[model samples]
Target chain A: MTEEHDHSGNPPQPDEDRLAATEFEILERALRELLIEKGVFTADDIRIAVEAMDRKDPANGSKVVAHAWVDDAYRARLLDDSKAAIEELGIDVGPAPNLVVLENTATLQHVVVCTLCSCYPRTLLGMPPSWYKSREYRGRVVVEPRAVLREFGTELADDVEIKVVDSTADMRYLVLPARPDGTDGLSEAELADLVTRDSLIGVTQPNAPSGG
Target chain B: MSDQEVAPAFTAGQHVQVKTGDPPGHIRTPTFLRGKSGVIEQLHGVYRNPEDLAFGGQGFPKMPLYLVRFSQTEVWDNYDGSPKDSVLADIYQHWLEPGAE
Candidate 1:
């Protein structure tokens, strides 16, 4: 064999280029550092509680809608203490006591938007969508809600009361849109499809069943 | 609930706006909510002012703040709001007054 194993005299070892974290990671690190420095929160505390953020499932919102569709009393209770109502079904609305849930019936249309930032009811609906965080959605939703709803494929009539809520302030909200007509006996999971995040936030009315 | 307080700058049901030098983005105090009026509900104290902290400062607990409520119509004239409609927002002591004209 030829002297292929020879390394001359000095050889350059691999530099081991590790992948860099994204902006999210950097910000997370910075915030974590600051939280520790300021003693506002500890890194371990965040690590332990971060599971709550992940435990959120969109199905939670659907469950509420489905139950409301079936039982009227349950619906009233939900409208009252939404946190308790959510918990009754094993879905948490979180300890953010300031959380408020608003429902949209056929006579009214309620749209939720965080004008200040992307503060949604993360406890029940999981994370927010990309469009929700966009400047266009934030500015337009608060200022010109009707137009924004139209862009989201929902056109409100002159009669339908349009309540554009600024989830920006202390009160955060989730819209319990009225269930589509004739979905009478659909199972919870089956009804969940009709309750998209958009529909729950009043951007889109619930999809009506094929036959009804 | 319990914090130092400065003299009241504006009476209840007065209009005011935010005048902080914080960065241009979705701040806690919204531009639209600012300068709008309904009524002053309570005087919430200030432990840490956002403007002082956002730019990296110890922010020696400035003069506390107050919570103000505003009707959608008052904030936006074209707002087709109902009689029983209103939203309350937290504005610092400096961000309030009688008028913003």
Candidate 2:
């Protein structure tokens, strides 16, 4: 949705027409060809990397959270060294930004937003949702966190403290939402199904599984 | 920015103020945080300078990044949240200076 365009009353181009190779696309093709010619990287390598990126999704983060909830040892490791902890589960965040996990407790809540740009834990959560990248969210979350959270239907008690984290540097954050009650008997995979992308982002808490 | 791994000048629990300036080109420091004071929550380790990396540089001299915490009331004059509410920002070393205790 972020684009540069002239506001001179020109009708918006159709999707098909716009997809038909614009100047930037042509330039990109030329540049890729040049890079391949210079032996910087191979076309096959690019293809594999793109495919791998596409495979990343919030389910990866859910698995980590689920394990943390059931295993106290893993929970401590996750908070102390998140990158290495995730690697133990075969999730590689190579070339992605460093990651940190923030724990949410009964008296504390954690929320994350990148006010400068939509910098997220892409390797864990995949592509960020449109709402996370909107100007409206970036501009207001830091100044009015409670109101913004209310809009997300997350009303917290006044006694609970809210902590809004602005991820602006070389690191990305994940909120380790408190484990929902009655989930102690569930297996790791079953618990993962209860976690959602919103909970990891701290906008909402994970829903309790049915028949728990 | 050199590629040297310099040690961080500040430490956790130290009060610091975000340096005020409008440097152009590929900056991560948000405008609203400039000149604001906060306490360092943790040292998040030395990493590549995003400002330099954005302009195609090697992102060297890897500066220390800190998690700084500011109270809701300190950041906004009319904050509607509970007094326990606080905001944390990940800021690079160069953007911060010592603050009054």
Best by lDDT: 2
Worst 10 residues of 2 chain B by lDDT: B1-10
Candidate 2 chain A minimal-lDDT segment of 10 residues: A1-10
Looking at model 1, residue A66 earns an lDDT score of 80
C-alpha lDDT (0 to 100) for residue A120 of candidate 2: 94
lDDT assessment of candidate 1? 0.69
- Clash pairs (backbone) in predicted model 1: B16-B35
Which tens-of-lDDT digit does each residue in A1-212 have in candidate 2? 74467657887666685566888988999999999999999999899988998889999999999999989999999999999999999987777788999999888999999999999999888889999999999888888887888899888888989999999888899999999988878899999999999999998989887982
What local distance difference test score does each model get?
0.69, 0.90
Tell me the tens digit of each residue's lDDT in model 1 across A53-84: 87777677877888877778998998887778
Tell me each candidate's i-RMS in Å: 4.4, 0.9
| lDDT score, candidate 2, position A155 | 87
RMSD of 1: 9.1
